[model samples]
Target: MRTLHIITGLGIGGAEQQLRLMLRHLPTSSSVVTLTNPGPVARGIEADGVPVIHLGMAGNRDLGALPRLTRLVRQGRYDLVHTHLYRACLYGRIAARLAGVRPVIATEHSLGDAQIEGRPLTSGARALYLAGERLGTSTVAVSPSVARRLEEWGVRRSRIHVVPNGIEVARFAFDPAARRAAREQLGLAPDAFVVGGVGRLAVGKRFDRLVRAVAALPDARLLLVGEGDQREELLRTAGECGAADRVLLSGRCEDPPPAGAAPDTLTLPSLLAAMDVFVSTSPDEAFGLAVVEALAAGLPVLYVACPAVDDLPPGSAPGARRIGPSVPELTAALREVRRAGGARLPQPAAVRRYDIAAGARQLMSLYENAVHGTPLPHEVSCS
Candidate 1:
């Protein structure tokens, strides 16, 4: 079945990266439409040869975009329309309905109790989301916790599908050569202890807490991937913690996405291999895709927010430490992980469970079922 995927913007984050990765694996014809700014990830998607249409909506309240999107949806003649993020969900759902598309599905990539649609929920935001939600045929929650959050937010329980975010596990596999190369590229010493984290450097991620934690570790250096509005603030916070010299703030790690039949991916794994331990300081996360990528890279982890790891069976995240959202806790975890070190990167069972190959197949099957008006595959319960 032909599918059209719509997202709010094409930037470097879990949702954007996940879309590119999923496209590499799914065995169906698909195209992408970004509602606003077509940034580097848009280039990556185009490099991968998937047609990307940029709907030049000036801002969130561009009501003119609705009819334009509706016209595009009608002309695409797609069997299914899939939406992601908040604005796309709202606009795409309406456009899909306007185009007479029957099975409009949305993927809820980054919903947390702490925020809604990348903004703190104001007086009537939840009410607005619920109204937008009703136009979709179904919604895909990235984790069980996100599913629960959606239920609490008044999304009908019957319309939610739990499909965790996944990664190309083999691509993230640890490599000794990669470790050395990445270290050399980043000017890291041959034997220096490193702690790394990857995500948008937003306030909610609590990266400031990481700067504080690193201040307590004299020898352990920090490598943070992803960029955001908090870059300047985080630089100042690192300075305040006296860890400015030891921190490396690498902006968005853009790797070429796959196109056509040749899906040669980029090398975020190499950077991951250079790190001794991975940490997540997010206050709350829906599925925590970066942590999974770290696990696939075989990095021992210390995390404050990862439902994807915590919800797994006991002993899943073996040798990984779980710490609270405090400076002292993170400091101790970093020190301990550094002290008890080597590349003893123990990948959790959860890593295997969220492999992108499996997830892509499941999603493709779900799309087929949606178009045919059948239930989701027996493996995934639609309700």
Candidate 2:
């Protein structure tokens, strides 16, 4: 079957990553369209031989894009139209309906309230989202918590389907030799403690709080990955905390380095494997993709206790250490995790629920059901 996947921008966010992974694995003939200029993810998709379309959307409400998108969808005769992020879901779904595409679907990647822009749910934005949901044949939620938020926001439960985000298990599989090589390549002291945090350097990511916590542990070094507008602000915060030297701000390394190399020099998996501990500071993460990646690399994780992370299996290896909202509590937990020594990391089996291939199969089924007017299979618990 042919499907069209639309998103706002193909940046390196969780939603963007999920979309790329799904596109890579989905069986249908799929094409991705970005409402705005194509970013890094667009390039990645194009490399995989998938066509990437840019609609030249400038702002939130681009009325001009609707007609263009509608014409494109109609011309392509897409059987299913899947949208991700806020703007794409709103405009793309509507455009799909206008184009007479059957089975318009939108995946709610994050909770309604946790949208990047502080637009209130009671505002016009929410109204547009609700309109799209009503027009959509189905809605996909990356996590149960995300689905619950959609329900709370008044979307009918019958239209919502929970599909937890998936990862490429083999891509993130642990490599014992690579781990040691990464440490050696980085010239890290044999006993040195490293805590790695991966995410955009934005306010919501709470990187500042992580810096503060890291400052408290003079012996522990911190690795801040990813790039964003707040990089300068975070660097200043690190300087202010007098931990500038201890903090290694390894800005955005999208591609994992070669095997048996350091992250700054090697791939993401190697970088992750070299870490003694992985920490996610975001308080409102919808699904902890980076934390799971760290776990897959066999590093213990310490994340702020949020509904998204608490959903992981209880007895999973490299068992997660959940802390309160305060920076002090996080600092204490970091110290505790470091002192406790190495623990078994989460195995691929524990995280199979988020497998990209499995997630794509489920999404393909949803698209089929949406087109055939048949009810989707009973919602399976990823837990």
Candidate 3:
């Protein structure tokens, strides 16, 4: 199937990375449209040879780009138009409808009861989202909790499909040499215990708690990867916790190296390699992609709230431990996991369930099912 993917921007975030990973496994013809900020991840998509159409959306209220996007959708003759994130879902759904696209699907990547696109939930936002969501044939949620959240917000249950996020599992497999090199590159002591977190440094993520937690651990250093407006606040928080010297922020790292390209030092996988224990302080995560990535990296994970693992059965991810959202709790969890010498990654069988290729194939099946106006038997979907 020829698919057109639309997203708000190509920044180095979970949804953007997930899109890049899925495209690598998608067998059919595909192209991308970024509404604005065609940043680092855009280069990675281009490196992989996918055509990226940048609709220079000047601001949130730029309605002129709608016609341009609709024109591209019609010209491309794509079989499907899949949207990701909030703005893209709003505009892409409208554009796809204008282009007479039959099956428009959107993956609700970052929404929960608490926050929408890193902002506090509001009735106006809900109304706007529900309005745009009606234009799509299907809405894919990254976890069961998110699927339920969609239904609570007025999306029909049948239209909301639970499709878990996936990653290239083996790409994050444990690598002792890579770990050593990564720590050295970050100017960290070889044996300094590390508690790592990966995500946009936003207020909603509860990174303020993570700073205090890491500070409480006398030997632990906090390595955060990603950039956001919360940097100044987090820096001040670290100082307040007396952990300013122990906190390390790598900013936005390079995208996963493209084929035939040398491995980039500051990439996500490298950050995972350098970490001994991965901590998730997000109090309201719809799905924790980074925690699963930590499992893939063979690091014991301590989470405040992760729908990805919490919504699953016990032992879904071998080393994952859910903890309360507080500094003492996170500090104790980190200490306990570190004492356990870290944990091995989940078995290959477990990893395969969330493989990006599997998710992409499921999406293709959903697209076909939607376009043909009939449900296909045995179609893959996460429970």
Q: Show how many residue pairs clash in every candidate, following the order shown.
A: 1, 6, 0
Q: Pick the candidate with the highest TM-score.
A: 1
* Model 1, TM vs. native: 0.95
lDDT of 1 by residue, 54-95 (tens): 999999899999999999999999999999998999999999
Backbone clash total, candidate 1: 1
Runs with alpha carbons beyond 4 Å of true place in candidate 1: 256-266
How far off is residue 200 in model 1, in Å? 1.1
lDDT (0-100) at residue 105 of candidate 2? 84
User: Highest lDDT, which number?
Assistant: 3
Q: Candidate 1, 36: how far from true, in Å?
A: 0.5
- Using all chains and alpha carbons, the TM-scores for the candidates as numbered come to 0.95, 0.92, 0.94
lDDT of 3 by residue, 107-145 (tens): 999987788877888999899999998999889999889
What are the lDDT figures for the candidates, one per model? 0.84, 0.77, 0.85
Clashing pairs in 1: 48-259
lDDT per residue (tens digit) for residues 1-383 in model 2: 88999998986677886787778788889888998868777887787778999889989756988999999999998889999888888888889889988689888876634563323355566776787789887788877777777888789887788777877877777887777887787766657798889988888888888888999999988888788888989889889999888887777765422233443466678778777888888777677778778767777778873444566566653356676767898899988887888554656455666677878777777877878865555653221
